[model samples]
Target: MTDISLEETIRSFNNTGYPFPEDKTIHSLFEEQVERTPHHIAAMFRGASLTYRELNEKANSLAYLLREKGVRPDVIVGILLERSLEMIVGIFAILKAGGAYLPISPAYPVQRVQHLLRESAAPILLTQTQLISRFSIDPDEAEVIPIDLNGPVYTYPTLNLQPVNSPHDLVYVIYTSGSTGKPKGVGVEHYSLVNRLNWMQRKYPISLTDTILQKTPYFFDVSVWEMFWWSIVGARVSFLIPGGERFPQAIIETVQTHSVTVMHFVPSMMSVFLEYLRNSQSDIQRMSTLRQVFASGEKLTVANVRAFYDVLFIQNKTQLANLYGPTEATVDVTYYDCPMDDSLLHTIDKIPIGKPIDNTQMYILGENGELLPVGETGELYIGGVGVARGYLNNPQLTSERFILFNPQGLFLQKPPLDPAKTPDNNPPLTESFKGVQGGVFQKAHLLYKTGDLARWLDNGNIEYLGRQDFQVKIHGLRIELGEIESVLSRHPLVRDCAVIVKQFSQNITLIVGYIVPKAENVSSGELKEYLKNLLPEYMVPNMFVIMENFPLTPSGKVDRNALPDPSGLFGTKK
Candidate 1:
């Protein structure tokens, strides 16, 4: 029987809840850090560096300017800018002015951008002068704030109002690509951000002398942690451009040029990086400063992890780690410090995503909500301070997932306060529902149903199996198959689409999309380019297989299994 309350567990684990710090908001943290370390370099992108003092003044200037135009907290302000210091400042400015920042990647389609703007009801949008024409929005219908980092600016706000709340306030909302349907906004509060950053700082201890590569897009949750973390400690943040088709090379050049000591990448990006490394004919040791490499957004395969350790980190001893968590869980819940063991190489099909950080608790349970014995597989449930406050404006989805949890074991409570009421506590349920006859009492358990399947090993480490539904994790990002189909359905060349995850190797999962073209002559390469403009490079299907029609299941839904295997078109690993 678990004795810990959810609230108690969070407190003990040092998880920060919303509305924290009592007096400061997310913007205030940036402002305070900037003021204290004015001369330090805060951001670096393509040979450009902005000092703390400069970043603060620029952000404040934009904030003042935006507020003058009636922008305020709770207002959704869209940001569609390239990865640069100005983009960083634009985000801070929005937050400082009490508005939530909504980042729309230019890589997405104009219609997709417009759809997000409409869904968010964002009244104001900040854009780069170069990409203004990409938006399908009418400027007259909304407030458009244009910032030419190299050009002139008219107004900069000078307000010094004390922030109304603390770090627990809503910091931003990042819309993830929905495989099940349209993109859903993931709300991350200031409290969760602070807690995550604090945990990272303590664990990695990145400092002013350290240089970290900000490879992920600013809109990605990983980027949020990356930008602020380096700023807080006076370290340097090197932003990479949206590499388009040349993403692998972009990552390589950044690491080589910046002498980046720390970096984060999704598995897809990492695979590309490794592929580039193998083909470049350059000395592997050229990546010397990369002291640590972390991969998430998909399962870290044994082969991939082993290759990285052998080829990239062999000479450098760069510590490689696998991080796992959901967006609703604030970036990461658990981590596995990868080991360089040749004997266990083949056994690396699934890496233990380590234990919960600080105050998080994870459970592996059987189908009926009972803890499975060691070496048994079951659904995984996580309870921690890292859990988000459910999805934004998604109450029904939230209710279904975030359920009421009682940790004192199951009970059939009798009528209120009856003196003779029997104790409500029921017998502690085991894997087989066998009542404990003589064992000592254990922590009372309150179970949460995670749709994921996992197994507890003899070593007490849990190994993730796979999803119980059609949900897929591509390059570490959760995607719903149905969501991809919805997006493809709207494409000009696509009449219909069926997306599936093809496991080519134990470590490699590819999103192979089969499309029924509106025009039979539509080429795969052409459709691929079309998608690049609408989705992130990672979400774009690796193999686009055109089909005449989708096979139907007996139940009338698209028969996913009946679709021809894509490995024939795209070569498999063994």
Candidate 2:
């Protein structure tokens, strides 16, 4: 199709009846892609690259090896690796072995990581020799399989393991930082993943000639899509080492070197990229080969968005977007292909995440569960294939968040089994679940209560109004204070901890952790040092406060409301 025709086709399809794949299971799609493009470049990590043929063979071999070791269908396996060629192999190998992969970031606290591994009951842990010390459990407790990409030294046995994924078979369980508690594992089914991958390929259309880049840690769900989707299309997916934060220059070099046509980044990282491009010695402004630039994880501010088009898109004519969604939804639910018209620039306050992608349906609802009319403010509830099955072992919390509703009846009901057990046809929960009466509706429509607040614009797009809770965005990163508290409370020196999103500036929110130390002698510097090893640098609190006792509210709860503001207490205002 001609360029205009292709764009028109995509727009028309989305406007009319956008056809999604019937087989939602990842196994079938994975098999089909491997069969169709065996010799095409499936993925690239630094100097190492794998063709579809090699990836399939390697996965098949690992599958057989895993089965020989007695790993079976429905089993969960922990994958602890950085963004590398081996990580991709481990994922497909787990799926091929009829098991699911649970991504555990090596940077996570050993205690929390161990909690997730034990909570999920994953039987095997996959990692590299460099990360062997991060495993929290004894090797004897669960199988620890260290991937020796360079020195396995022997051919792996080959076997075509029949795909055993029921429509509900688990694919991967990703633990999102919990704002109110420890990190909770969000379980995604094979079909949900398949639907997402299929939709992404159809919408984004990365091809054999496209070279994609995997920048996020493998533990992040977006990385999962980065590796597999490119594999399906025989596209090259380059890897950025973990230090891409410190060496944005190297990332630019890699993109230039590989002639990368497609890349994904969080808004914070995109800022870093745009900053690097503006200041760099390399004339990135002239590199017109880059085609697609996708950003998510946080809103793309007006200034940053404009700077992006001025430099990146003006040069490359690339697609720029503010893709939106939480991990509970599969990577993204909506995308707004950014507009570049100068006339519309002044009126664009917030880039709308645009419409729901493919099968996903979004509802703006009032506090009472009623569907807010257009131009009304309400919480955003998402539905359809992009919605996750639910949290991995926390049924109460899952049921609380993922509700069932009937659009026609406007009723809400608590789901009985895991939603994964039920098909999507349980009923269409189109309206928001509100009030006590909302509990009676039980068709198949699963309602995902996104904590985000949004309002419909007169133009039919939704504008995000930030969060209703203490949750806040820092450096364009979405963080839940509960998640920080959960991780901090686990520290031996911390007797009690409270984490809150304290905004020091209009653009900056710092994670302020207030801790009651086990002893009076603990120092804030020492606590920061301890957290540096236990969590991702972003998750580490920017400032620490040691308190002998927390203020109490009338309700007898810790009075977080009474805590001194960071600007006043710390003398550090953003």
Best by TM-score: 2
RMSD for each model, in Å, please? 9.1, 7.6
TM-score of candidate 2 to 2 decimals: 0.85
The TM-scores of all predictions, comma-separated, are: 0.80, 0.85
Score candidate 1 by lDDT.
0.69
What is the alpha-carbon RMSD of candidate 1 to the true structure? 9.1
C-alpha lDDT of all candidate models, in order: 0.69, 0.71
Q: Lowest summed lDDT over 10 consecutive residues: which window, candidate 1?
A: 425-434
The positional error of residue 378 in candidate 1, measured at the CA in angstroms, is 2.7
Instruction: Compose the digit string of candidate 1's lDDT tens values, residues 426-471.
Output: 1122211122122222111222355788775655456778788878
Question: What lDDT is reached at residue 455 by model 1?
Answer: 73
In model 2, which regions exceed 4 Å deviation? 1-17, 134-136, 285-287, 407-443, 475-478, 486-497, 503-509, 516-519, 529-537, 547-574
Best by lDDT: 2
C-alpha-based local distance difference test score of model 2: 0.71
Off by over 4 Å in 1: 1-24, 157-161, 244-249, 275-283, 341-349, 407-450, 458-460, 487-497, 503-557, 566-574
